[model samples]
Target chain A: MFEKKRLHPISIISHIAKQLIDTLFPLLVLVVMKARTVSLGWNIAVPTVVLLYTTLIGFFTWLRFTYQLNERELCIEQGVFLRKKRSIPFERIQGISISAGFFQRLVGVVQVRIETAGNELGKAEAILTAVTKKEAEQIARQIRKVKEGVVHDETIELINRSEQPNDIVFSLRFRDVFLLSVTSGGVFGVLAAIAAFISQLDDFISYDALYRKVQALGFVRNTLSGVVAIFVLFVVAYAISVGRHLLRYAFFTVRKQEDMIVISRGLFEKQLLTVSRKRVQGIIIKENVVQRLLGYVSVHIIHAGGSLDGGESGSVVFCPFMKKERAASVIAACLPEYHIHHEFQALPQRARVRYMLRPVYVFAIPIGMVAYVLRPWGMGLLLLLPIVSYLGYKSYQMAGWAISANQLALRSGMFRIQTIYMLKYRIQSVATSATWLQKRKQLSTLAVAVMPKMFSKVTDVDEKEAEAVYTWMQ
Target chain B: MAQLSKRISERAVSVWRIYALIRFTIFLLVYIIVCFLLMKFDGPKWVVFLLAVLFLADLFLFVLLWPRWRWQRWRYDVREQEIEIEHGVWIIKRTLIPMSRVQHVDLKQGPLLKKYKLASITIFTAATVHEIPALDEQEAEKLRHVISAFVKVDDRDV
Candidate 1:
């Protein structure tokens, strides 16, 4: 067993900040409402009391919380009054992640999260809110050593482990990072959200006044100039998106050490995740329309236990941007268990009719209503037919499945293409479904349940091929 | 390929019919309340007639026909290596959950199922859950034990 240790004193302030962050928005709204109605003294007094209460609570929380790491398990005892104690065995821990924010880095302490394999979402089994970077590394190394059954000579291994060299399997290049930010769909997503938010403001918030203000600002004069203004808005959104990606993945690097993949990244604040290799369930290679046109793709790993916080959206991004061909090499060098290929078995030609008819049937009623309402202008609805046909064609072209021995790879998408590579062991279930029409055409949809609910589906595949996948999974 | 041999209890049809009837009763209550408000507001009286016709049609289609059709389609085969479940009214779906992937199995009974002396067995994998609904109580218990043995043979978790 080890001595009980408390988090850094800095966590007292951090805990207060974390608590405030949860209510900061509502607290601000309340303060503004009070500021308009109540006296200035009361407004200041209210915030002061809230801060004092939070600080006092943070102090006691930090004081009460203590953790101890032994050779067998990690034990945590924390509570203001209840005095709850929880212990997690080393064998049960799925992985460990370490991250340091701006403030934590300044104070040389990192937040340590011990992840346990379970069905829970956004939860870490044990979180040591604040520990020195050296301590965090020692804990991680000790856990890894114990998990590997190397606790026999802990002191020497602990020292030599710090000297353990990690093979740099992959990293983002300077130019590649710029290219990634440029082609990232995140910018468009932000722009669409901003557009939606602004459009909603017309109902009550008087967007007319805002439009007039923009007119006054001389950004909009005629329709052509309005186009320029919209273009400027897009540029700003792109810059913001790029800045965010740069901050988050500037020094991104993936390294292989023992049975763990260490992914470290960030510019201002560093984050490192040590994922157990066996804990990774699958891999996904993704490409948006823009990235696909440019022949670039990103690789992400589907992991089981890590929290969604501070990590890549429930799955870790192994490669932010790389050529499709280069991604194969990286997977070969780093994770040979999964395989990726651009070529997949094509769907039968008869199935093409089904894909083409889908968009037409789905949009027919809506387009008819629009055409009816618009009358003369409604003739433009015919133009949508070609676009939808192209979509259907793209879906047919992109959706396919290929099995490489023990691994199954599925490429499928509508607008954004995603190719999921899953080992036979990672697939929870295999399904083959066919409607009457598809059955007549000897076509069935093949789908598999994978982690993170990334169910990969190859629609309108040859039924025999679907049966092959089902048998392979069995 | 061959079709799955095992079939669920025929009592499943009656169980499903009762379940559908409960839902239809709730739908009727809501529809009647809506028509009452429409009458108060002097809304189109035709909607009242239209909804009544639709309600009766739904009672015939769902409460009467759907349960029988669904029960007939429900079939499952649990072999030594895997379990194949086939169901779905229009789009026939066949799923294979390998025995090595099964995480656990459970036998459950609600008040209505208990009244009918029926139980359901749910087989859980790491990512998906499959339920064979409305089996005889003893049959469900046996099926659960069988699947539990298979799941226990494989000690790995996803």
Candidate 2:
């Protein structure tokens, strides 16, 4: 089904309009905020031109795009001016996923993405922006049938057969999302973003005047009030972070249907992604300092193709938050082949002195220069030295590695602990290195690469242990 | 120190020396341009003096010292099971890639290498690429064939 046919004409409006809104929304806000300074003619001129340009792009993009699917491969020819051709054989296809955004939902259509065992880092092989749900499902089914070497009997009402019931494997609750985001660095991230945004907003409005106005209100006067104001600010940031996390992971679910693990989440964007079980490289259970203290961890799936935009990282977050004790069972329920181990062989004692001294040596020159420049004012920054030492100590404490059967679990972190669990068969390569000092100290840094260009390393391990790992990998 | 069985061609030293010289000359040219600009603007003479000192130090450190150290450090071994590579002047890194995981092998030749009758063999596993740089052309060709032959027909989709 393809070359002569096109997606629903509404795709032009729904898909392109969403992109235009995302890109132009901030610009539009800026124009309106500065409308008084700029002439009415200029304000109207900017939006009018933007509107006309987007319309032309949308129309041409839709007019030029077409896909053709045959027994051998799926071919797509698109681009308004520069004709681009892409073909994917059925064997290379990993899976197909359907998602819907607000616009697509309004038009009762879904956006379909085709994923392959692609060499490209972070992109889907093909995307059908707007297609009927039935057609999308049929295409997915047909591709699967072809890959499985199942002969298609088109004479029968076979495509209409209901799919295997999905077994729900893992899910995230609102309470967990709230707790996860509150304790996460995300609160600080949001607060920093807001602070930076307000700082930049001076271009449109003056916050200095607003600050004086607030001072007149006596909002932040004495130390007690200042403390309370800071507290209030933190509470607001935490609230926003939780709200964002909740919306992003609302009704988050993972279900297995045959060989595919399907993940669906998001309140507005409604992302549904499928990962072929065969293509899963490994899983990493990550816990930051706060999460470790609270006994919570997040699990991420490392897939081969890495085409699915799982989250901020290439690995997809399987469960945003789970009890540290419960993580193994939760992961087992979904992917039983991997055994997540908690016990680890800690770094050698000699490594501790090296770890602790590293940060000091790195930050010494910079801190000294700053202190020299700022004198008494910057000398206060020296207080951070103790904390830096403690961080290095913590990194030494956290670093560990273990091997069981044919699987390797490597744990390393300064502030956030990540335990990468990969089977021996899945490991792409292993590299061990040591500086002259490290070699003298009998310590080596071992890096294990599971996905293309993604490496998890444990530095300052016993050279013997590193050698053992190499032997194990061999 | 652990020693790998093989070393790159001796010509690699001259190649790196030539590269370092070329790079140093560019830096010298840029410094000349900057001095001209500074003179045009009647800028500080101390600035040019400071830069000249830095450039001389750079010549000593990079153009003279680095190539020999790099050539001395680089080594590799192709075994039946895995290909091991060790390189780096200060922090020597040894990477081991099992034959089963190798995706492909490439023998690449650029203008400088061609001029010297040398080539580099790049071995790509699923995750990273390791290059044994500036080998004899025939040695690189042999390595390309050996690695390709050793690479299993079915990689575990790595």
The CA lDDT of each predicted structure is: 0.80, 0.79
C-alpha root-mean-square deviation, each candidate: 4.9, 4.5
Segments in model 1 whose C-alpha atoms lie over 4 Å from true places: A1-6, A12-91, A134-166, A186-191, A196-204, A207-232, A307-314, A357-385, B152-158
lDDT, candidate 2, A1-474, per-residue tens: 354558788888975677676667466667778788888887888877877878888988899898887776888889988999888897887656677777678787788777666546677788898887777766766676787733221211221222323467877777877787777763346567556544545577566875786577754343356458557766666676667777778878877656667777888878877666777888988887778888998888987664575454358878888898888887787788899777899999999988898888888888878777655556877876777788899999988999999999899977678889988988889989999999999999999997645789999999999999988877
Worst 10 residues of 1 chain A by lDDT: A150-159
lDDT of 2 by residue, B1-158 (tens): 35788999989988998999999999899999999999999999999999999999998888888888899888999977889999998898999898888888888999999999999998887788889999999999988888877877554463
| Cand. 1 TM to true fold | 0.84
Query: Model 1 clash pairs?
Result: none
Segments in model 2 whose C-alpha atoms lie over 4 Å from true places: A32-36, A39-56, A80-83, A149-166, A184-188, A195-241, A310-314, A357-382, B154-158
Candidate 1 C-alpha error for residue A27, in Å: 10
lDDT of 2: 0.79
lDDT of 2 at B99: 82
In DockQ, how does model 1 score against the reference complex? 0.71
DockQ of each: 0.71, 0.70
